[model samples]
Target: MNKIFIIEDDVRIREELSTFLNRYGYESLFSINFENIIEEALKEKPSIILLDINLPYFDGYYICREIRKHSDVPIIVVTSRDSDMDELMSINLGADDFITKPYNTQILLARISSILKRVYGVSRGEILEYRGIIYNMAMSEVTFNNNSLELTKNESRILNILINNNGKIVSRDEIMKTLWQEAEFVDDNTLTVNVNRLRRKLEDLGAINYIQTKRGQGYILI
Candidate 1:
């Protein structure tokens, strides 16, 4: 069963969301201690997260950004704020989707399922190995010679696609499309920055020539 972490401070909203998710066969972990939302999320390792914009101690954007530092788990912003700015901000913070308050349960469920399918199901393959480097899609982690390589969310996603399509060129357009599918916008340089950061991490892990950039083409795992 997929685990879902809810980080809403409203007890009523949290319980309602949890119960609704449970009906859809999802195991929900509602956040009680707002001060330790990240700790709980790390401990639970949820498949998806439902976050609210108005949190108690810390805001949802902060939590989402923090989580994106290490994990690429699907996050759906469920909040009362209906502003387009809020939605865009959530996406900018790395949320997979957004749902406003008073949302239809059926629509929410559909969105959740769609995001999960696109994220964890389609983009990922089995554990990928290349040049003694191990990239585990399920765990969203990489290891080299038994030493784990810490990766950010974007780094992990980039490595996941490249390593899974080993020896094949992955178009930059394709990557940008995937990353921006949840939102209407993505900065032109965001993908470039992520690729550079990922390459640096790989180099630090003693892996060279892993990601080869093709001029006027794309990137390939070599």
Candidate 2:
């Protein structure tokens, strides 16, 4: 079954979309926790995401970018902002398609079906493989040399951030935010613990110490 993660603050729109998606044989998951939108998205591993531009804790653009880091799951932006620039900006941020608000439900469903077919149906699978490791961004499942490896939520988040960067530096603050969202009571030690767990997993897989710590800088997937 395909899961569709809907991240819109408007309760009315959320309900309508969820209902429509269910009718189409999709499992639609809606989020009320604005602060944890991205975290929920990662956990759900939806087949496609319907994101709104304006959100409570953080905007949809940030969430889209965060999701892009670890998964290539199709992101079809469904927002109220209809300006040409808004559409262009969304595309630049890696959105697969952008549909402005006040749109027909049928049209929205059509766009979603199209994106899903293009990304999942046309392609053979949803997981991205690198160095014999399969990273299933949708299910957040990872397998090393064909064996399923268990990973904590935080550990999966770390891998998602690093793999998305693809040899780029991801700052510690960014990682912290991705994990903790708007919680004001996050401790540095918590992040430290997550990173340690992720490193151990990678080491067990014989992956080079590719996740490097830049003293005072941030972590990077080298």
Candidate 3:
């Protein structure tokens, strides 16, 4: 799972963001020590950051600039400062994205997903490892022990979501939405077929019962 470092001083907002992100399978990390914010962030080595402008000690812009000097981690400025200048300054100081306060949480999720995809999805041979199975996303293949099986596009996506969320029960709706993000119509039966095929492929590689269905809920990767 990806770790998101939050730099908001408001305790309630920080806790809320952490809970929301956690529900979506992300690990959230934060600190109340505003004085060593930069150092703490660098040490944590988070996949991304959610920064607040109105902070104690040093503001977010300075932290963003200083962090930029050391690392290229994606930063999204989330603050109440809705002025054009705030957005522009955030961009100028190396923020990858900006969102004003009282924002829609769904939009925030989308922006974070977009930035993460852009930053991490460009590698030539990206692979996800879980429970001794290696999923080579670039080549659409899953390897276990010495056996390997090729997967179709739909099967690959379904497996990707399951493996990313690992032990969690991923809803059928969420899987369909990810598989067909731009489609006007989605067939429920199609997802079942793809998931069944993926499970069969895993079985072929000796990964028996890797995916378990939770009755009317969804599927979990065990």
- Highest TM-score: which candidate? 3
Clashing pairs in 3: none
- For candidate 2, write residues 1-222 as lDDT tens digits: 788899999888899778877865689998798887788887888888888999998898888888899788889888888989988988898999999878755445546655776777732224444554556554566666445567778888888788778677888889988988953579877887888877777778777586788888789876
Per-residue lDDT of candidate 1, residues 1-222 (tens digit): 888898888888888888977865778997588898888887898888888889888898999999999899889999899899999999999998998888756456656666777676832223556777776555566776556666777788888788768899999888877666743377767888999988887888788778899988889989
Prediction RMSDs, each to the true structure = 17.6, 17.0, 14.6
- TM-scores of the candidates in the order shown: 0.54, 0.54, 0.57
Rank by lDDT, highest first. Answer: 3, 1, 2
TM-score of 2: 0.54
Model 2 scores worst on lDDT over the 10 consecutive residues at 122-131
Tens-place lDDT digits, model 3, residues 118-190? 8986322355667767776766888876578899999999899999899999998889889998534987888
> What are the runs in model 2 whose C-alpha is more than 4 Å off?
122-222
The TM-score obtained by model 3 is: 0.57
Scored against the true structure, residue 47 in model 3 reaches a CA lDDT of 90
Off by over 4 Å in 3: 122-222
Could you tell which candidate, 1 or 3, scores higher by TM-score? 3
Tell me the whole-model lDDT of each prediction, alpha carbons only: 0.80, 0.77, 0.88
lDDT of 3 at 126: 51
Clashes in model 1: which pairs?
A: none
